[model samples]
Target: MTLAVPPTVPDPSVRSAIERLRQEFPELGPAPIVLVVRTCREELRGSPDGALPELVERLARQRLRVSLD
Candidate 1:
């Protein structure tokens, strides 16, 4: 009998986004915090100061709460 192996998972873009956020907002916790970038282009284009508030609100609406630790 042959053993089956599980497929590899792709690295989530959210992780990098969260890391950048942590660097930009040191008061926030580490990159393990969940983050969803609604608009990738907008996030990459805009300043972190402007982008973070929107990202936080969007995630909150989805009931994915985040906090600075």
Candidate 2:
């Protein structure tokens, strides 16, 4: 029998970051913005939890902006 794993709940800050990114980069669409944010979150895995949200948002924003060029 296979055990089912529950979906991971995103951190509130991360969710907020995603929403902000969606608003800022509406032209890129939700999928790309989410991918960028998730990538940033993974890259920042070792960072202190207290700062992860802000750092993730900043990094994601920078990446999204660069993608525009």
Candidate 3:
């Protein structure tokens, strides 16, 4: 079963990286303050033509909070 995780702000590192990505991909608009758990991961899954997973990996490397059920 999947557990529900509370919404939380990204770490400073994630904020920084996301800001940079935001500038590069205006399609994403502003940097997100809160990560919506699994959906957030899905959003960053990246399109075949785009390479956003590398960017999301930054969060995974940093302190992006998450929980598994």
Cα RMSD (angstroms) for every candidate in the order listed: 11.7, 6.3, 11.5
- Candidate 3 Cα errors over 4 Å, as ranges: 1-10, 31-69
Per-residue CA lDDT of model 2 for 1-69, tens digit only, reads 122232287566568899999988889999887777777777777899999999989988998898899
User: How big is the RMSD of model 3?
Assistant: 11.5
Candidate 1 clash pair list: none
Better of 2 and 3 by TM-score: 2
lDDT of 1 by residue, 16-66 (tens): 555555555554354233333333323333446566555544543333233
Q: How would you encode candidate 3's per-residue C-alpha lDDT over 1-69 as one tens digit per residue?
A: 232244374444344555555554454344332342233444554544244445544544343333221
User: After TM-score superposition, what is the CA distance of residue 50 in candidate 1 from its true location, in Å?
Assistant: 22
Top lDDT model:
2
Query: Deviation in angstroms for 66 in model 1?
Result: 12
Deviation in Å, model 2, residue 65 alpha carbon: 0.3
| Model 3 worst lDDT window (10 residues) | 60-69
Give me the displacement of residue 54 in model 2, in angstroms: 0.5
lDDT (Cα atoms) of all candidates against the true structure: 0.41, 0.79, 0.42
Q: Rank the candidates by TM-score, best first.
A: 2, 3, 1
Best by TM-score: 2
Against the correct fold, how does model 3 do in TM-score?
Answer: 0.32
lDDT of 1: 0.41
